[model samples]
Target: MDALVLFAALFVSVAVGFALGRLSRRHLQSQYPKDYALNYYKGLSYLFNEQPDSAIDAFIGSLEVNSDTLETHLALGNMLRRRGEVTKAIKIHQNLLARPGLNTRQQHESQLELARDYIKSGLLDRAEALLLELVKISSAYKQAALEHLIEIYQDENEWDNAISAASQLDGKHYRPKSGLGLKQLQAHFACEQAQEDMAQRNFSKARTHLQEALGFDSDSARASLLFARLEIHQSRFREALDHLHKIPQQDADYLIEALDMICECYEKIGEPKALQKYLRSLLAEYPSNSLVIKIAERLRWLENDYVAADFIAEQLKQRPSIRTLNRLVELHLPHSEGRAKENLQLLKQLVDRVIEEKPSYCCNKCGFTGNSLHWLCPGCKTWGSVRPIRGVAGE
Candidate 1:
């Protein structure tokens, strides 16, 4: 059925060509047998006979694309690419580039289209080279080429190259749709390099990269989070506590991320009681269900189940979350018996399923949801867009 529609569309193309020639055939047919009207008629006949190869040849050979019809070709190539026909789009754009009479601007436009075709074809190296040339040759596509180059560098996991390309967008009039600003994206690239160093256990190098990242964007809570983790790896509990504490100063929305790490730091220093007091102070200031949940768990570990359960129940009354509700069920499951035990079991399973199915992170820019957070949103490729899902169903 789709093939039939495609054939109909092809017939329409030939019909348009025939109509165009009809306006000028009397003057053109006497002078040239290669007249557009005659070629269109021949292509239509081949198509009617179901000889697609011959029909394609007739169509390609007929169109004498010039500056006057440049937009028509560009639009057709763009439509082909949009239809996932990258090879066909490449053919059209390549033909335009090979022409000798195009002006400099038209050549640049063709280069941009061909470069996009190369990108869609997964020819990253070819696309990168062509885009770099386009950046140097024409401001007409500078922003678009730079963005595509950044994407290519990211896909290659070349963090340094990505950072350099992103930095170039600072004053080049390339505005990010997420409003991340070039500086913030560069910071994310630095953080990515730092994460790589951390994975290799190169602590000092990771610290250096993280410091640079913080310098680039001081409001980056992700940088502070990494700094805290590095301190924890070194067993510098005091430093780690300080670093974790700084997350709130940067962005209070991310304070929940540091809760467990903060508790760990305090526990390492033999200060559970102090940790409890600090968390209470934070709860007073922040008013978040995540902080409340952490304090309840700390109480459960230090005091008794009743104390923890009561605290969580009271907090749930004020501000509730799926995470806290799951914890609540667990707190009473061990003590309940008979019908109460069975009821608790069912509730626990239901709540667990709910929490598992729900996404933990969401991209504010594009509304993409995931269980894990990403510094750059996979949907939008915008830095710092994925954030914790907050409210009753989440953090």
Candidate 2:
């Protein structure tokens, strides 16, 4: 069917070319017509015959080639560049720019198009030079140039220049501070500085950068988690607990993330039972699948399998998860018999495979999903967007 369509299209193209040739001959032979009609028909014939090579030749050959068609040539080049035909687009724009008698605006537009073609072709050095020059001479193109430079800096991970570009573009009619845009940039910059401090073992400086992140966006779960970890490293168990406690307030979906750390801090402070009681209260309120699993683990340690298994069964009834089901199987594996034990083990394996195959976290903003936590979404570059999945298969 597709081949038939192609053949039909080719036939129609030939018919159109024949009609154009007759029309061109009729229109010309009168005022010498500058041979424009003749070249246009020749170009049409080349296009009809599926010969782009000859078509380009005929089009360029047919040019009455004056200032009037400069914009047309620029538009053609821009179209080719957009279509990923960078080499062809470059030739067209370069030829247009080299022509004499182009007005100021025409020259500026052509230069901008050529610069964009360079960018599309991965010639960043050439693109940057032309764009920087265009930014001064063309007020209309400056904002666009700045935007492109910002993209380049982001791709290169040059946060300082990205920050500068974002700052300059913010708070204007043409451009406003993109909240997610600036926030992500600031967070990454802080994260970068925090890593430097971590390398130097400057815990206090790293803490300061994390604090700076919270100042910019208080809902930064990654920053909060990092601050909690840092406090634990410094043996500030109480402070770590405080930071852990703050996570739910910052973002309730990540409440599960703080559970393990909270228990650790409590154990460090020699208050396991007290922490268990608090978790029991929280489980009553939140009742998350993750919280239930953790609580069941703690229950097994403090009590017996009977109590833990009962707890798991109760929660699984309320909100079933493959993870919760697997844990229940693990609890019963020790006490079960011949065929039942083998079947339970197989079931556990299946459940584990299901959970492992699925991404553990997802970004609500960009829909990026991965097994590991990412403070900044690698897909969308949005800070604090990637979070644990929260349903049957998730936490």
Question: Model 2 over residues 63-112: C-alpha lDDT tens digits?
Answer: 53355556456656666676677897788788777877788777877888
Q: What is the per-residue lDDT of model 1 for residues 262-348, given as tens digits with 9 covering 90 to 100?
A: 999999999888998989988888778788888888888889999999999999998878889888889999999999999999999
TM-score of each: 0.87, 0.74
After superposition, the stretches of candidate 2 with alpha carbons farther than 4 Å from their true spots are 1-46, 49-82, 90-119, 128-139, 171-181, 196-205, 277-287, 363-367, 375-385
- lDDT by candidate, in order shown: 0.82, 0.75
